[model samples]
Target: MAYNFKNGRESVGDEPRSGRPVEARTDNNVQRVRTFEHQDRRITVRMLAYELNLKRETVRKILTDNLSMKKLYAKMVPSS
Candidate 1:
């Protein structure tokens, strides 16, 4: 003998979705700078971002603020 509710409702437990999408970083330049520092190699921002799996803005920030690459570039420019 099987027992059933008067409404014949089926019990379904709440389950988490397994197909959720992962968030992707939008800035690639920032990631590029990070990759260069990590790998200790010179590479284009585009390539660095691709390899580092980060946003470009992140790489750009690192190069400008943390690495001081922008300062280096400024010093390289001859005084006019």
Candidate 2:
């Protein structure tokens, strides 16, 4: 960040990269994860990942960050 500022970059935000942007945490995925959770709260992160063709970490993020959910007693439940 300091280097970028010294190089005359105007903002602190990240610069655009060359490759395609990540789309794992999209709204569609979030909704799909939520629907799957509602259909079967006992679904595990690995199972969700396999079923949705997403990464385990991505599924976990959808559950914990997007859906505000956590694992409890081997089941997914709302954090609050």
Candidate 3:
């Protein structure tokens, strides 16, 4: 905070950041998830996320939205 004041920063809000936004939902990732699911139908979302180095929410989204799957009896099952 002191450094910012010395540097003549006017506002206290966060500065504009530069870099590409994180995009976990890509065709390649989706394909990889699908392949892993095929190999093991009982894999957990946390395991999948850790294995893929992606967020758990991202893995869940891929399972539900992209793959149309849902949890049943603590296992991933295809939604009707």
Candidate 2 lDDT, 20-70, residue by residue in tens: 568779999899988887898678899999999999999998888888887
Task: Give me the candidate number with maximum TM-score.
Answer: 3
RMSD of every candidate to native, in Å, equals 11.8, 3.2, 4.3
lDDT values of the candidates? 0.50, 0.87, 0.90
lDDT by residue for model 3 (1-80), tens: 78988998889887778896577899898999999999998899999999998899999999999999999988888999
Model 3: weakest 10-residue lDDT segment is 14-23
TM-score, candidate 2, is 0.71
Candidate 1 or 3, higher lDDT? 3
Off by over 4 Å in 3: 1-18
Each candidate's clash count: 13, 0, 0
**Lowest summed lDDT window (length 10), candidate 2:** 12-21
RMSD (CA, Å), candidate 1 to true, equals: 11.8
Model 2 residue 5 lDDT?
A: 79
The TM-score values for the models, in the order shown, are 0.39, 0.71, 0.73
